[model samples]
Target: MPGERKAETMEEVDLLVCGAGAGGMTAALVAALEGLNVVLAEKTAQVGGTTSTSGGTTWVPGTHLSEQAGVPDKVEDARAFLESVVANRGGARLREAFLASGRAAIEELDRKTDVKFVAAAAHPDYLDGPGAAYGGRALGPVMFDGKLLGREDFDRVRPPRREFMGLGGMMVGRNELGALLSPFASLANLRSTLGIVGGYVLDRVSYKRGTRLLMGNALVARLLYSLRKAKVPVLFESGVRELMIEDGRVVGAVLEGPTGTRRIRARKGVVLATGGICWNRKIRERLFPAGTRDYALGPQTNTGDGADVAMAVGARFDDGGDSPALWMPCSSYTRPDGSLAVWPHIILDRAKPGLFAVDAKGKRFVNEANSYHDFAMGQIATGAIPAHLVCDAAFMRRYGMGMILPGAGNLAAMLKAGYVIEAKTLAELAGRLGCDAKVLAETVEAYNRSASTGVDEAFGRGSSVVNRFNGDAEAGGSNPCLGPVGAGPYYAMAVRPADLASSAGLAGDEFGRVLNEEGEPIAGLYACGNDLASIFRGTYPGPGTTIGPAMVFGWRVAKHAAGKLTDQPETVSGVMTDERTKNATL
Candidate 1:
């Protein structure tokens, strides 16, 4: 058997990281920086999995960024918040580990790599719990110029989702959205708009897409560029087909790549950071709740290959999250090219004044200003299979609905495509939406009464600080998240729940080691990213919850593999440091 297997080309590396998403890239980069010969393998041609198309917020509390920004936060308060909100699912240890090592991990990355982050001035935690903050916990990636990576190297990084782009592939960030929408609103906004558009125009001359990356795209680009500087080889279009185990230890992996089959011998360890089981139908059917539709925002390539291989080698999964998956309510419409465009309804219009979500029966179900996860939970709890986001003409024009822009640039096209439903009256709208006319009218009347008084009796819509932050500040109402739906010309868009990422994944220890059925670490095997069970056990604590832990644990895995594990928060400089970091006073 050994002789027969020798036919395949064999390569050696200290650390072999499978997947090139945020987590895997972090591991590869960290391992290289720690003096390990590391190689990253991606299943697709490009790097950055779901991360490239996401908002790219990383939520790690008590970091230098937070401190520099003067955000008031205490570790104990964060613990209290977690304890109050998260289910007691035996994940407290991992959660504690995350909180403890987060700062060090971030500082290390900042000191040794090109991955830079800026503290969000006012990005609040999802839930306003005891330890919740108004801002500074969530960090966003700094804007990156793709030109720095050069055109060829930049092409290897995944682009943002087409629906989120403008002018056929120009990426935009959440903060710049206001300026992009109303370029002439102010002189500053006009300059910003001109700069962005000008950059895009210039980029189109040489690149396939705009080289001005922002949000998740920028984060990915930064990581990729850093990996290049470290001279780490990221094998694109390569997949690990089998994990080579010897005497109960993972030794290496059998990879199938563009060049053909080969055996890569890993001297140190193998980190599995594949993007979880998002597109795995069999596992999804078993893990997901009954009646859930098959919709996920992650790439189709994430078919649970890593989990399958790990499970085959005696790894057990921890599927006990409060919810099996993290969710976002999404509305879909067919593009002109016959492709489906699924737009995630995150913070654009749902929380603004004069909007409410109703079930098929035309009765309000949840607070429109609640976090996306909570909003999806409300849909599931109330059996709102396809919830209708109702708003009047003025509201639609001021704040977009689904993929429709604020100006309703292509409203007729959207209506024709059945993406939006418009009617001249409440009864007509209700009839078109298959709701009871009387019930719909009564619901609107009750809502208008509460809107007039600036108080939502059924649900405290804008009572929370985070809620008001997303609402239009210029709205003429006491509650920015509550306003009366103007008369006639009502609009409604149907949305359904979709998994933003998987929470249930392979059981892993605090050190990022994959655990066997006996609850012991599998020697030389570690897992991070969505492949590892969420530390919060399926609860969304704040923005960038998934990505935050994915990166933190990724760094931990690299340090542990390189024999440089340390709990100290002291800042360290330089790359390829072989010395074990000493513990220092926090």
Candidate 2:
């Protein structure tokens, strides 16, 4: 393939990054800062991919932010948490690299760029089982102004509409909501809310446009602004159709853009951060046979394009069984196009109290208030009839139900529509859902007894603030954790295990290099975010677990590609052409 005629194509860059999501953005920013000419391409018209739709929390323990917040986190504690959950799962080298590089990445972002970080005060780790801190381990992005980007016509990426509880009837974070509820805390929350409302109203009146509030959206805005400042050429609405390979190495890519087909070469590397296959129906049917109808909560553009392209180029993948990206239980509403806008928080408030999610034989399988990952895994492990959330009259009257507008009539309508079921008693409720009546009754009785004692002896239901947050506040007893509902009019609704996104893809080493079929690292190829198999394997250690690793790995990959490692060889030589060849040494 030597001296092959150069094909007519667009200009090349030092690095060509696909997918402008969190990982891709991080990689692009890092690479560009290292003096590499970078071009970041996104399939969507806008940048900030799924990160725009997330909570913007990154779980990194032993960081300076945590220390500044007065929550001391030790490396030993973090190691303990990892050992308790994800150690020895897979790719140990990668896990070590992640842990070692996470803090440095955060520091680099804070010092070199405007990516400010603040600890999510008091956010509990997912397990909280043992050696877990009650908050201060996770960091969230502070608010940034979108107007600074100077792209007034562009659709700025923001957090999911649900995560924004600000002015204009917006949503607030759980911690903020709790502060709003407490009398003393309410005063602070009130002041914050008023400030937000006042700023929004003034901006709207003066500018003749609604003011955009930042929470999670601030993370994306900051990244986008940084990318802009760095002058990284972002090709929007452009997707990689295939890896253009020659002489047994990747040279460029065939991109299907809005205008026409185009090929772009990469001088240094191609980073795959196109996200995972969460929305593809065919893949969903293959992976989740039972819950095929559940719409993914992530971006619709995530269709495993990167995985497919890598496979086409002779890359093997890990069998990420039972590990599809999952979201919380949601209710769907039909859109004008006759499709569905699936909401993610349907089961949180309504199903937390009297409702006990049971398997086929009517047995409680998991703590109701565990993280969504645990809850979804429980659904998968049950493998019986579809999970059911069992509830009572008190739960119905106080919490309302589902995604429908909160009202008694809506609840009745849902019941009539078969989305929810109701009966005069627990046995009757089980009978309606075709579950064993006696078993359900016993489960409810046991739960009620635990509620009376104020401690969930069975599953430690009230052990964490997350658990109590969703629990029935009015349930009285020595244990505010549980309350018995002996009253009539019980209910049950079928719940399907859902995912926020899938976490499996191309396998990478400690430096995020894509491995070939023979388990050898492919030079100049890197991956991060959900596009790479999770370093934790199947276990989630805490909140922001996914994003934290993504950012860390992204930085690692960028550094490695930029030849920052002193111990590593200065140069890795391989043929760079547009033709097929035998395996050659690097």
Q: After superposition, how far is residue 6 of candidate 2 from its true place, in Å?
A: 6.4
Give the Å error, residue 349, model 2: 3.5
The estimated TM-scores of all candidates read 0.95, 0.84
**Ten residues in sequence with the least summed lDDT for candidate 1:** 569-578
Question: Which ranges of candidate 1 are over 4 A from the true structure?
Answer: 1-9, 566-586
Q: lDDT for every model?
A: 0.86, 0.68
Candidate 1, position 330, lDDT: 93
What digit string (tens of lDDT, one per residue) describes model 1 on residues 272-349?
A: 999988888988998887545488899889898888888878898888478778989999988889988999999988
Leading candidate by lDDT? 1
